[model samples]
Target chain A: MKHSHKKWVTLVFALSIVLMLGACKKKVAPPPPPPPPPPAAPTASLTANPSTIQKGQSTTLTWETQNATDVSIDGIGSVQPNGSQSVSPADSTTYHLVAKGAGGNQEATARVTVTQPPPPPPPQPTASEEDLFNQNVKDIYFDYDKYDVRADQQAALQADAAFLKQHPNTKVTIEGHCDERGSTEYNLALGDNRANAVKNALVQDGIAADSIKTISYGKEKPFCTEHNEQCWQQNRRAHFVYQK
Target chain B: MKRLLSVVISVFVFSVILCAQQDWIRTGTGLGVEKVRVAVPDFKLNNATPQNTALQKTFDDTLFYDLEHAGIFDMVSKSFMPTQVPGMPSDVNLAQWSSPPPSAAMLAFGNLGATGNNLAVQGWLYDLKNTANPQVLGKQYTDAATPEGARSIAHKFADEIIFRLGGGISGIAETKIVFVSSRSGHKEIWQMDYDGANQHQLTHLGSYALSPRISPDGSRVAFSGMTKNGWEILMYSQDLGRLVHFPHFGGTNLSPAWSPDGTHLAFSSSRTGDPEIYVTDSDGTGLKRLTSFAGPDVAPVWNPKTGGQIAWAERSQVTHLPQICIMGADGTNQQHVTDEGFAVSPSWSPNGQFLAFSWMRRFGPGEPGAQDIYVMDITTHTWAQLTHGEGRNDFPSWSPDSRHLVFQSSRSGQEEIWTMLADGTQQQQLTTSGSNYEPNWSWK
Candidate 1:
């Protein structure tokens, strides 16, 4: 019995010593684990949600960075390392983000495309009498600020005059338009002159004067939405509408 | 919703109060007249409600802006005013208002509130230098609690203050600027408050409407609209909200101008081969030819005060530059107001002493001249250029008080309506959206 007890005590003492040695080794450390691999250089990535949209629509931009101290996106200024934002682009645009850290700067890009909305459906032939009149009668163009009939527009006016003569029962209203320029009042007068010039041409062409009317729209009605000379020229014209 | 409304109301009122205490500098001391230095304190609230708070803010803002644009006063900034906004006669501390930083000579303070459906405001103007007789003027205005009523209340009070302090000339606070806007995808006549608020599209012709001239009585607008019949002078009644009939002469009629008494309209018509000025009753009868010029004659403006003369633009030949000309209301005594350059759109001053016209000096090919507004003394035939090389400025219309003019300019890239003092000072742009043109000040 005394020998058995001595063996058990010796085994217990050995096990405690071994455990203590293992703890001491851990406390002392084992070469510092190679300094954590020197902290990898900063890398940034950005992505746009629903990367395509109709024109004027908005999209969400999200970014994430690895080991970055600062992050910034092109055209968007500084932002958090991990965050998201909403952006609206009138056209296809590319967004870039940079992540800066002690090691170096890294960048990534995301793109969003904005497409134009589809054009409206074509008007039906039987939509209305006014639509029919507008579609059939070609409009005449005018010079800026001057109301007199241009030499080139006479053929279109002659065609309109002949149409008015054929459709004696249908009264016609000549609409005057001007490009967006000059004073509003002056444009009104100019538009009047243009419309009158057309009516006078029609009257001289053997169309009954009573079948025609004129109104001035002075720079108010624009066929083209662009601001360039091409658009302005298209806006300055005389359009015809038929009235029962 | 209630909390949001209250917060918005409070912030708006506070900001408006803060804005009134801005720089009190006056630029139009051209004639060596000392500007009236005045301080407008934030109106004290007599009673508090969410709706009233919002209305009070609008009223205070409108009043402050009106006073600032008077062109005769040096407005003291609110930052310099004393912390206490004394609203009434007995509550005011004269020394605080008359003190250093602002050194205001006059004080305009009032108490305003909206309760239920009604709004009331009491405004007082005080002469700070005169301690014994400190009160310069006092006015009370009441109306509905709506935004329009609040604005009207502010305008009436401001006008009263101006009448009492601005050398006997009336204020244009209650005026409306009738102009054309193309924002609706088409040209339409629009009306706005004198300070460019509450913009409303008056005509929805869907076609183009132009040259909207409000009658002296504010009952109708005589404009030219395109109809199937041709460019006939169409009249739009303000009260009827529809087109009214005008005698059609089977040709182009445009640029309708109203006489002072609202009895007759003078317009340019092409019924007689060339555009010529003509006069007719307001109902479109009793037509009489006013100008028999061989070339184009257009844009006739009546002298509302004189009632016996009209000014128009006349060209001796179609190719010649148009010149400003005046003739008797009876179509006699024709005289040219301008001798040189391409001048048009002549507007007569309310007092019948001056004619403001758009002129392009050195108007020819390769000349570096620009269109500018010029005011002429009818008696002396002497003129002074009010604008110089600031884009193309034209369509000079006079304020009812004769102290200011509204004109159209392309200086800001797009044609925008602008206002300036009679001596060409304090130029301010009034419209910023879309393109605005031909601003006509309403008759008081």
Candidate 2:
């Protein structure tokens, strides 16, 4: 038993030396881990969730993103960060969002969707002929200043596009929008340009000219509360509805 | 179940294809010019009394005059009605005239009535051919002490009518225009319509220019230019289109203004080795020192109502922001009124209660597009920002009536003209497409 104990002590001594030597070797050659990749700047991206908007009145194509360099919206709908586009699909419109850097580059494509809006409610018997327009229907909006479509709108926009493609008999109008950042006339023109741009895109996708129209409602309607950038984001967008 | 669901879906799809929408506007095919027609019937007495019949006619004519002056309508004579009227109709008969009076879609009409001391007017539009229900345009009652007095209420009615029509005013002969141009390449001076349509350059000589001014009476324009070299005070007469330069030996002389009485010009000069306020004659002589502080002071304007003071900017330090200071015309009781940031170009209201000035919050080499206009209540130390959002908006000049202001704004993707009310409402672009700058309003 004493002999066995002596052997155990010797083993312990050998194990301690092994551990010390191993630690010493690791300490001597410790190389830096390549300066930890500059804390990957707050991630910005565009995303669309449910991926769809209903038809009739203009619908808000919603989205989300993080670590955005800067966010801008184009083509009928406003944009949020992380590659999200607020699509107004009178029929079906696919909003192409290019998440860019300060130098204007495609950083990411978050939520790509073909939006289709559902048919509007039938006119009321008591409704004046102009009552449909009296809704003062303006463009749709997103969360304050955000152009990203959270997962909620993805499926909706795609279904909308497919439905519009199948129903080639219907015509649609795309309305561009902007928050109240600039002059009224200028904003209106900008909104028009955005809607026209989106309409042109839809034509590229085989939507006919006679079936699509464009308009701009510069900063006329907003869904958010307040005058800051957050609310402004919701105000800047393309809204889709029947041109009639 | 699958087959039944498919059939139901097919039916839904069929109806979706069946309900296509249509475009209904007449202009969708691009054929119509947006326009309105106005008709002034020979003034008829609506009431039994003829006491102010002549006055009523004048009043109705004035209302017609203001509407026509707005440039939104073609005034037509109802006496030339193409045919006998049927029943009264809503809206005006615009498209029926064979000669076609300007091809308008809307029309306005009115009637005048006179009672003992008062005159009442009622106006409506009638679709002469369809005369089923007429659209009433306006109605008003006023005192008819004089023919001209009777017309005053009509003018107000006309103004309201034009406003509701969404077309702006036009041919304001009483409203004078001011602008700046480098047409001769030296950034001299110019004036034109409030619309920036009829442009006329005011100065023609060698002057590196800035800060153009119009006197209280609109008879002349005063600006800072360098005729004799570095900088000098310059004045231009509306009648002769000639410039008279104010003189001083100094580092620089810029930002000229007229005394409330129009006899003297208050300006900034570095004559005492540093910029300070100076008062001189209209011909640029007899310079009297106004401020004692040894700082950069510039852009002086007299109080239109009180004539009790002049406002100018004073740089507190080399790195400190510029502040606006007001003092008596001779430079006593001087006190700092602005402390927010780099403020300049102080203009007083005709009522002497408020001052308008340009303030730059952030400083870069020259601050590319951040300058904005602000108004301050002298009695209440509070100020409000007028112009905002992208591009440089500065150099605010107030109208003689204190109703509106003309300012320089780089808003049209280029520097042009802008106008807004004194309370910072009804902001609109005044200049047509041009590279105009430095708007100075005239009291004429």
Candidate 3:
């Protein structure tokens, strides 16, 4: 009877060891609800198709993103979403995409290289208005609804200052701005703020304050959308004017 | 202002002579005088043009576009011409250049000043139709120390030629635009001449700032910005980066306007529930409320033409529909102008006879909430639509002369500033790139 009992204890102990081995095989908490599918990473992308853009040429950018209910572009000027974008990139142009899709967020990118507009078409006997107009246009942008000189605008501002410096005889008028989200009065003030922001910046960059003037149109102008920051973003900015 | 005027005159002269007339015009197209043809003398490289250089393209293109954009004269195509009009019409391309063919009438020429270093362009427009050799215009100037300035030189030259052609220089070639950017992730102002030359940034800080207004006096600016708390009216000195904010953080302050005297700041705020117009000292003192409304109101412009009359917009009933209103500086004689869909951003003309407001076309094809700019004759009470485009446009400010209104537009799917005649005629885009909105004309 003692021999039998000892045998039984050995058998129980062996069974316990087997169970411990199974437990140590893998660590995890009952597979944890499959982790709600990773918040879908807010599908985002920027594209510059016709990849090679000229210094002053327009290119089309197509951004396709899904899942995100909201989105915005970080440094590049105002852009609207779609399958195509007609962009004249003077500098490195990027299109920031923010979107939402069913599975989650997905992102994509398109690069654009403006390979210097074809040498003004060999100085045609007669020039095209687009060429001059493109050169005349100085693209700019602002933050949310504010019109202050953002740090990003420094390059363009300094370039403008340099132009003013060289021209010395040239005078430019600064126009302030605001997106379409605020009241007219508020936007006007914001526009003034934007214009003044530019004037202050230009003057500080060594352009004479007397040489630069300003104007404000509060939320009166919208470049892209009727409702989203995509469009409102364009509405907020400062512009300049130089006399003939 | 005097300095600006002198510069204008100089640039006008400098641009006319330097900017080359295109082949149609250089070759002579759009001459109105079908029989009138102009010759582009081969451009001589007073400074040699580098092969396949961006500057060369930029310089050559600058001259071509400036002349064509003027729309006053016709130009011949380069390919159509026997040889490239190398420099200016004065260069005399004895081989390919001719008169009386295609009814040529005038001659224009100029030179690219120097190479590697900044270039100076000089050109002249002559009416060949007149035996007197009518030397109509001439201009010369310096560009950026490098090839970059070639565009500016071209622009200046174009402006002069346009003036000579009697097209009235309002288009490219002479105008500078200022706006904001966040390439550095923070808001700051920037500016560039009429031609896209020399881009730079101003104000390098981590804080988010906004609303930059240039004073008619061209000495200072006013805007709404944050200083710790929320938003407030900040007056910035164009000469000194002096950000003077009102003593208190006004409720999300924005829409800053300068009184004709440049001593007062007319702005819009909601410190009292609904947004109301208010006036304050340029230094941020003497706060005075100017409007009372249950609904949102904003865009205050002190009329330089109307003798201190304050113009703005207010919502009398429903939030969606805003009515245009005007009152005195003291908030007297309150008057309502419209009972339409939605109206906001009231800008008074320098002459004060008109007020330009941003009007939204309630039902449109492209989108539901598309906006437009409108001009109201104070005496007639009739409204005129200034811009008609695919996308939305708002923020309309009239030129000092009141003949033109500058506004923001999203016609090309990008927000940009544009100018249109008060009659809504010549709608030209001011800002070509970037997202820019809210344009205010300067009395200066």
Models ranked on lDDT: 1, 3, 2
Deviation of model 3 at A129, angstroms: 65
Each model: TM-score of chain B?
Answer: 0.90, 0.62, 0.71
Per-candidate DockQ values are 0.13, 0.00, 0.09
- lDDT (Cα, tens digit) per residue for candidate 2, span B323-442: 788899888988888765567778787657668887765543444426788777676546666777546676787765454567877767766778776545557776654566778777
Model 3 lDDT tens row, B1-444? 212322332343345435534111111011122222455444456655453245556776777765654444467655555445546544444333444343445566666556445566667666655555456776567666465576666666666665555424344454444444444565555554433345565455455445556677766656555544445666556577655445663445766788887788877775653457888887767888887764456767787854568877675464335668888888999888776656777878775666788776463235466577866667656655667645777777665434456676778777676765555655677565556655555454
Q: Write the per-residue lDDT of candidate 3 for residues A1-244, one digit (tens) a residue.
A: 9999999999999999999988887664457555555545555666666788668777776665555564444444334444555767677654555555454544455556556454555554553333443465464687754444677877777776666676676666666667765344545545665676676677777877767656565554455547676776666777665545
Ranking by DockQ: 1, 3, 2
The CAPRI category of model 2 is incorrect
Write model 2 residue lDDT over A42-77, tens digit each, in one string: 433444555544554343444454544555555634
Candidate 3 CAPRI grade: incorrect
Chain B TM-score of model 1, please? 0.90
The full ranking of all candidates by TM-score, starting with the best, is: 1, 3, 2
Interface RMSD of each: 3.2, 18.2, 8.7
Model 1 score (lDDT): 0.80
